[model samples]
Target: MHYSFSKDFFWGAATSATQSEGRVEGDRKGENIWDYASKEYNHRFFDGVTTEQTSRFYEDYQEDIQKMADLSFNSFRTSISWSRLIPDGVGEVNPEAVVFYNQMLDELNAKGIQPFINLYHFDMPMKLQEIGGFENREVIQAYKKYAETCFELFGDKVAYWFTFNEPMIPAEAGYLHDRHYPYVVDFKRAAQVLHHIVLCHCEAIKSFREGGYSGKIGIIMDVIPVYPRSQHPADLYAAEMADLFYTKSLNDVILKGFYPEEIGEILRKYDQLPVVTTADKELLSATKIDLLGINYYRPRRVKARESVPNPEGVFSPEWFYDNYEMPGRRMNTSRGIEIYPKGLYDIAKKIQNEYGNIDWFVSENGIGIQDEEQYLQDDMVQDDYRIEFLEEHLSWLHQAMEEGSNCLGYHMWTFVDCWSWINAFKNRYGFYRMNLETGEKTVKKSGLWFKDVIENQGFDKNN
Candidate 1:
């Protein structure tokens, strides 16, 4: 292998409970926000496909996990459903859910696969939603209880724990962009929600420490490095401000245990500062994480605003900068995201230089291909584009590692083609493609190629 990794480097893929495990209303599982939202507002999801039509991992976990082992995965990252564990989100633990999860963990251990478990991935319980979701302090406390329960239950079996996945998505998509559930376009509520989510993460870390679990705990963030469209001073300033609001807002809090002063200033200027207490500060300070998970799919390109925003308009991140589409940049037409592999290297260097070179990993990175069936050849899907995508990103990651970044591992966005929020199955992003109608899974060309890469510990660039 021309690009050999460390002997202990993690080689695996990632998935979330809401996106994979499809027994939504079964096994005494309480309705989550996704369940309620998709059903009530069916128009949001493509083809009106609800969460219940996901990969059916609840029933086929054994088979799916076996496939992972066969594919030479040494590690895997998945989230525990908050509603599945505690059906009501705060009361009693579900017995069947416990059995299922325990069995799943045991199976992974049996296959010599390390399981990295996350607590939340945008699946808020409906009961909690009724109480204003993460915007309410009471909901934060409820999340604390939920975190403690998880530690008490599964801490022994699972060593790697993450408090949440892409914590900012809920605030940005749900509150600001109206793309997620409980859709509202209010910047003040978005700020409050973002603050409470950070506190909730801190509360989980505090619980983990107090519980004395011998494992690592952290949070997964979607880190999109912001690049200025040009060297012009205005463009540079716009990029800096965009980075502060979009990336550093969550990262600074998790890795440094404090919000950036500029972020606070921006929030205060808009009268959108979240209500912060002295106790919240102390808790955040005392519970910094032991690891970091970065999910990088693309870079954010920004330029100076072409025109002034209306003073009467509601506050939004775009008020200061405008998105710039660089000419001749590679594009993922299927997903409408610019394909920039160097973003991973840029993020790694930034974390190394700015954030104390903390222990971290590439948690979620992959391309989503629409109409993937068109590439099917015989029994396998010839996903050469996906393979090329991974190769380029991994090359950049290897370069970052050579420069002494403390990146520990790399896991792609998913193990199998599964349901996506709003998009549903419109875009396929798995090594194994699942037929939505029959629940049949077949290994794509990328899956076969990834097995060789994992077994050899790396890939040959000359290939």
Candidate 2:
């Protein structure tokens, strides 16, 4: 297939501030939710412990940037840790962090890799968490302050800015799903958290605008397309509900300047509609994104499970959307999501046909493997499967671009294997292998393949 993307297409990888940067519990940097949660649940990580080196991006960003350059990436996405930048999430900026981040930006730019800086990526300062994290409205103001600080400091070097990375996950995972820090399994709290996060995103956008920084700013959402099981009406409705809850909930606020009707209905049904202030709507309406960064992983399959009364004896939005697994659907190795390449096309179409014509980037798309070294043979992981995965997704993206989707680039989930929470150090979704036992890193076969893809601007299937 002659799958050619834009000539100016950006190709790179993504990493977060907390997962890869392992100064988790430094007093100088202030504590984050990850640092505390890692200690509290040390036994859950795939590496069997929490407090250890992860990719060592914090200590060796310069070398890693060099590695990224070696892989032929023209763009690199990373986050500025809120705690590391401002320990209290509000006070004086850390001089060390400023020096470090500036050095990183300079290094990447020197190597012709454009830096895409994100403000937050699941690393809320502990001091803010003490005051209820995203659940509290005051945190939104603090986030605005944080965004303004970042713009004032790094605006000169970085042109692409994202307000939040997968903000919905933290709201749902932490407040509703019991999988993350401040694990409260209450639907009311979940809605509250979701509301506050959306507002924070809007506030951040407003901050970037009002701070007199004229550059592209948007939010990065990890959106999983929802597919129904067959032609069943219940299944289709359930999928729609899931899409609204997961994807549209943020898109409506960011793109449409209001929440979806389904959201309001669910909130009214559960009597959990947040008490929105007059300023909240104003802030949301005032702030609009110049672009959107979509992190597509997989699609959700729904078939309408039997209605079980809220067993937790607590209110939940799930009452509106039941969990259902379609039989005979293609599932990911993660076993939780389905691998649907067409979903990327569907998302791009939706964005173009519905959300107006806004520029977008495939901010994070990758597969998780059991082990990076498992596929290794003679110093390289012959990860043809990963190459296939990317090829299929990019084909869909290419079709989208051909049909007029304003897609700018594709950045994989990560550049190197880094530690994750609870299931930390388990899944390897990096182009490079990182050995924790020995501070060594090596490029995998996928990295070599990605190097060519970036160099060629698309995959040469015939080759």
Candidate 3:
């Protein structure tokens, strides 16, 4: 290989419990917000498919981990379902759930694969959601208990622990846009939820440290680098504001242990500032993370808004900037998201220059192709486009690493084709293609190419 990565670089794929583990209601798994919402609003999901119709990882984890080994993965990222681990989200730990998770962890360890476990991934226990979820401080305490339980149970085998996956998504989708469960279109509630989530994360970190666990704990953020639509000063300012509101707001609190002053000013102006107690502030300041996980899919292109928002309207992030669709930009038609590989490089450079050059990794990055069956050839899905997408993104990541960025790994979005929130299985994002109807899995062409990339420690474009 012409290009190679460090010997310790992690090469693996990621999946969430809600998206991949099928036995949603079984094995003492209590109902989560996804289960309740999918049933009540079945029309919202594609093909009326529910979370119950996932990849059956609960029962097939052995075969799945073997497949992961087949793909030459040294580290795998997955989440522990809070509701599954502690039914009703609080008091008692389910014995069956414990058995299953222990077995899964043991199996991965036996195969020489490191497990990176995340605590939350948008699957809030319904019991917690019944009382305003993260909006109430009581729920934050409950989440701390849950996180502590997870550490006490599995911290020995899992070295990397993440408090939340895409933490901003819950605040934005559930509160601002009404795209997720407990949908409420209130700006103040969204701000409060974001605040409580950060506090809860700190509490978890505090608990982990208090327990004397040796593992590294962090948060996984979806980092979308914001770009100005043009060289105009207005557009540049718009991009700056967009980045502060969307990306820096959460990251600063986690990395710097304080909310960005610009974000606080905007929130105060709108009278949407969250209630941050002095104790909470001190707690945040004391707990710092050992690693950062960044999920990059696309860049946010923005321009200055032509008109100011009405003062009487509810505060929103879009008030200062407008999303701009740049002409001639490459688009992923399958997922309706722009394909911008350079955004990864931009994010790495920002972390290197601004965020203390912390140890980090590409926790999630991949392409999703709708109706990918047409590309099948000789039992393997010929996903050459997906391969190209990986190559382009990894090339940028390699360049960033060479430039002194402390990036440690790269993990694609998924291991197998699994159910997405509302999209269900509409868009396939997997190295191994799963026959949803038959529960069969076949490695795709991208999977084979990735095997070579792993074995060689890199890929050669000129090959």
Candidate 4:
């Protein structure tokens, strides 16, 4: 591989507070949905158990930051648990939480690793979850308050801010797919949840502005490009619809200040369009972000199928389109997602052409495998497949830059192996493996390769 990113490129890695931290039930930290969901779904997790040590970032930030700096990374992205900051979801900051986060940020800064702080990362406070979580309009106000508190407290040290990380997933997974907490199969509730989440993002952006935080604020959305299975008109149409609902619905509102016309039609077709109040629209229209974080994982393959009416299965985005498996497509180690690296460039191109020029980054991109150790040997995980995964993606990203995309940075899905919700320890996507049994860390060969890429600004063909 041979490549050269811009001299000012922000190269780093990412992790979430809930996914990587395990001191969840201590220091007056309120229970988050993940905390309860992990226990409730423990039987489904790996080894018929749930995670207890979970990367141990809470007790080992010093070591973690040391490794991150050693990797030559310039930035580290993580989220702050809202419930940890305000145990009741509003008012009264927990001094312990404040001290912990302050220390973490200060440590990263001292190591020359800029912190990109995300306000929410799918860990809703149990109290808020009891009140219907994102489905309830009241939670939007609560989220705005939480955002304001974060800006007021950490704004100075943390200049890069994200309002929500993959807000769409929770809405769909928790409500429609019944895969996450508060598992309810309700399409109407999903639509309402989606609307409320989007409103919360916009309100948080406004709150940052009102709180006088003169820093960049944005939201990270997971966008998997959709490819029609064939050029057939129906397949093409269905693929377009899938793209609108899965990737563009939330993004359209954030970037364009309104929902896409096709999405509106789909919503109305199902009679599930959210009852948008005048105030909601006003706030959404007025609240614009300073940046956008594009998290591209894979592309969707869609084909036309006979529409079957389902009166009770809970309407889903897939109901609006038929999903297809592309014949002989390159599959990831997970065997569920396809490897389509060009999707990243397509995403960058879309942002450049449709959404006005804005600062952006690949906030989340990585490959996952069932057994990472199977690919390891001699004190190193020789993940050549993983290397290929990243190199192919970056090649397209380089093309996007040459064609005029203001992409500022690229961060992988994680810095270390951590617990994934139901997936548990089933899949690993870390450059450095974390030993859950002992909370020890070891760098893989890919980690060394990444350090070279960071130092040289890209891959070196001669190497």
Using Cα atoms with residue i matched to residue i, what is each candidate's TM-score against the true structure?
0.98, 0.96, 0.98, 0.96
Model 1 pairs whose backbones collide: none
lDDT of 2 by residue, 192-235 (tens): 88888888888887777777786799989887887777678887
Error of 4 at 174 (Å): 0.6
Winner of 3 and 4 under lDDT = 3
Candidate 4, residue 49: the lDDT equals 42
Angstrom error of the Cα, residue 69, model 4: value is 0.3
lDDT of 2 at 421: 68
- Give candidate 2 regions above 4 Å deviation: 24-27, 334-336
**After aligning candidate 2 to the native by TM-score, how far in Å is the CA of 251 from where it should be?**
1.2
lDDT of 1 at 434: 96
- Tell me the whole-model lDDT of each prediction, alpha carbons only: 0.92, 0.83, 0.92, 0.84
Query: Model 3 off-target regions past 4 Å?
Result: 24-26
Candidate 1 residue 275 Cα shift, in angstroms, is 0.7
Q: Model 2, 375: alpha-carbon shift in Å?
A: 1.5
Q: Per-residue lDDT of 1-463 in model 3, one digit per residue for the tens? A: 3668987899999999999997744588998999899899999899999988999999899999999999899999999999899879999999999999999999999998999999999999999899889988899989999999999889888999999999999999999988998888888899899899998899999999989998899999999999999999999999999999889898888899888888888888878898988998898889899999999999899999999898887788989999999999999998888999999999999999999999999999999999999999898999999999999999888999999999999999889999999999999999999999899999999999998999889989753
Report the C-alpha lDDT of model 1 over 347-449, residue by residue, as the tens digit.
Answer: 9999999999999999999999999999998978999999999999999999999999999999998899989999999999999999887889989999999
Q: Residue 59 of candidate 3: its Cα lDDT?
A: 82
lDDT of 4: 0.84
lDDT for 391 (candidate 4): 83
